[model samples]
Target: MKAVIRITLKNGVLDPQGKAISHALDALGFKGVEEVRQGKLIEIELNENDETRAKQQITEMCEKLLANTVIENYEFELTPVVSS
Candidate 1:
């Protein structure tokens, strides 16, 4: 199984990195972008195949270490691994 997690700063939180990216884009001549919000995408491979158990474990991982729950919000999707 694979867990794909998306973590981003909560609304109203300062995002200096995002701001920097926005500035860089403007300098590069990109137009029409009002804002940029930086985020993290984490993919974890799990030996477990059960969806229920995988979700539970991934949730725990996000809450404990994958994200700063106080300032960041996380959402995840679980997909089955395919072998050729």
Candidate 2:
């Protein structure tokens, strides 16, 4: 099993890095770029075969360590790994 997690800052939170990127884009002549939000993606390969159990475990991982529940939100996608 494979789990992909996307962690992003919640609305109303200050994102200095995002602002910096937006400014850089404008400086590089990337016009019409108003705002930018930065995020992180985490990919995990799991040994569990059961989809239900894998999702549950990944959810726990997010809550425990993967995401900061205070100022960030996370979403995940699960996919089956095909063996060659």
Candidate 3:
């Protein structure tokens, strides 16, 4: 099994990195660009194949270490690894 996790900052939080990206885009003449938000993606391969157990483990991983729950929100999707 595999998991893809997305981590993003909560709304109303200052995102300096995102702001910088917006500014750069504007400088490069990307017109009408209003805003940009930055986030992180994490992919993990798991030994467990059960969806329920995998979700539980991924949730715990996010809550414990992957994300700052106070400032960031996290979500994950489970994907089955294809056998070649």
lDDT per residue as tens, model 1, 1-84? 999999999999999999999999999999998989999999999999999999999999999999999999999999999966
What's the residue-level lDDT of 52 in candidate 1?
99
Quantify how close model 2 is to the true structure by its C-alpha RMSD in Å: 0.6
Give the 10-residue window scoring lowest on summed lDDT in candidate 3. Answer: 75-84
What RMSD does each model have against the real structure?
0.7, 0.6, 0.6
TM-score of decoy 2? 0.97
Q: How far off is residue 30 in model 3, in Å?
A: 0.3
Indicate the worst ten consecutive residues by lDDT in candidate 1: 75-84
| Candidate 1 Cα misplacement greater than 4 A, ranges | none
Q: Against the hidden reference, what TM-scores do the models get?
A: 0.97, 0.97, 0.97
